[model samples]
Target: MSEHQPLSVDGQPQQLNQDEATQLAEELKQQIRNGVIPAGDSDSIERMVAGLGDPRGLMRLTFAESLGVVGKAAVPSLCRALSEHDSVTVRRAAAKTLTLIEDPRALPVLLKALLNDPDPVVQGSAVGAMAAVGAEAIDGLLEVLINPNSTAMQLGLASWGLAFVGARAPEALRNAATSDHAEIRCAAIAALGDQIQSLDDSEARGLVEQGLKDSDRDVRAEAATLLGKLHNPAWAAPLLEPMLNDPEGQVRKNAALSLMKLQATASRPALDVRLSQEDQTDVQAVLKLAINQLDQAG
Candidate 1:
């Protein structure tokens, strides 16, 4: 390979030997810093995108950051490479690069990669991009959450996206909280925790109350965990107190831990009662801890 390989020609990736790639990547970074190709200069942009495939980890990161600086002008090419690149390395880099750019135009490509990419890293990068895109990407994330065909990994990523953007999408989170799928409900409830924390939104808090009663034990446990993070004993403590006797031991345990987090001294009596009757050794330990913590707080 040449000592100084040219970037991709006509948007086609050309193989570059490691040394040539390093030199070319540094040159491109300099050009980007000097504002050479930010106007979507086709050749320069394609070269920058191609640099995402650099075999050197540091070079690849440098190229991704530079492409991010190129901003919206780089979205189209990045999207194409993310969806079509034969190299998983290129595809992964492209998705991660879009996360820094955070242009809404890349959401479609990111969503497709999240759902269809064979590589887990590529799929996760797509989720990160959608999250960075913020509110505009909420509906798409919710769509994945509700789709029965969505894999556990995909569902997990989409749920993460929802939590990340929850404050910006309260209405969407509310709708998702009522979803037929337990997984969707669990995700929505968790995201609502974000909404409650960020906005102190009353409606989001109400939905979390519903989550505590969800048919799925996991969802109920998730709801119990969400309440502990709210830091509002007046509201959260009352909600969690009743959960001490929940049929599910995990739910009861989470309720005790949450009460501990709240320092809900008022709930110590309830904790004391549960501790004596608690059959599960783990729940008993958690109840004792909550009571002890509350006693110390008082």
Candidate 2:
């Protein structure tokens, strides 16, 4: 019998196969889960990192998720994969695993990927990972947003990550709101909406109010949505009047929806007039809904 002969299973020679390899991989992953990752186990860490580039998508994802289970010991290998891996899939999975690990040490690598990665998917995953890191990642993410070479989508992702950081992110967001770039400004304005509850009343109101008058229609629409969330009836007329006359149908719809939230009876007359001239079917429906809401409140 050859020394390399297949193992016997119930007295029959069983050939080593793909199924066996997969089972072995799974068992190793479980062992890592049970805290078998001894210090200085560079070989095991390398094997797990290599598994992240597996041909099978499920296997790749499993390895990525398992990195978190491997804990801090996996960070160095994962970071190397994130920065040096030739495969975008491997790099993307590494970014995701770092996020799952939530180690602050990964911030620099994630920020680099968010700003300069050729692949948008990798950049997007990096953004999500940055958000997962929360307040600690804000300064680095803000640097990306302000960098001249950053793409529009990159700035947008940076804004979203800052927004996810919420109240902890006001200073960076405030500066970004005034950026020379319109997309960055719009993203910043929209992000402020997420920080409303944490902001002082005047600060929150001032930021949203500024956004309401912004030249960008998207900014104005976002302001209207945030105003509704504020639910401060004092500003209902400010929202109801100018916005009802705004050129953008979406802005007009948002204004009407905000009025509905405030139950501003004062807006009923203007809304009625705007309803007559409103061209978009969707805006007209929202206008009618706002009118009904006001009537019910009265």
Report lDDT per candidate: 0.84, 0.74
Predicted candidate 2 versus true structure: per-residue lDDT over 1-298, tens digit per residue = 0112221112211122445437746876677678674333656666667777667778777666666777767877777777777888778888888888877777777787887789998998888887886667767776776688988898778877878875665676777677666666666777776566665545656777878888988888877877787666786566557799899999999899988887778878999999999889999999999999899999
Clashes of 2: 0
Candidate 1 Cα outliers beyond 4 Å, as residue runs: 1-12, 18-27, 39-41, 146-153, 295-298
Superposition error at 187 for model 1 (Å)? 1.1
- How many backbone clashes are present in model 1? 0
The lDDT of model 2 is 0.74
Model 1 agreement with the true structure over 79-149: per-residue lDDT tens digits:
88998889999999999999998877777778889989999999998999998877788777877987888
Model 1 scores a TM of: 0.81
Question: By TM-score, who's the top model here?
Answer: 1
- Highest lDDT against the true fold, candidate: 1
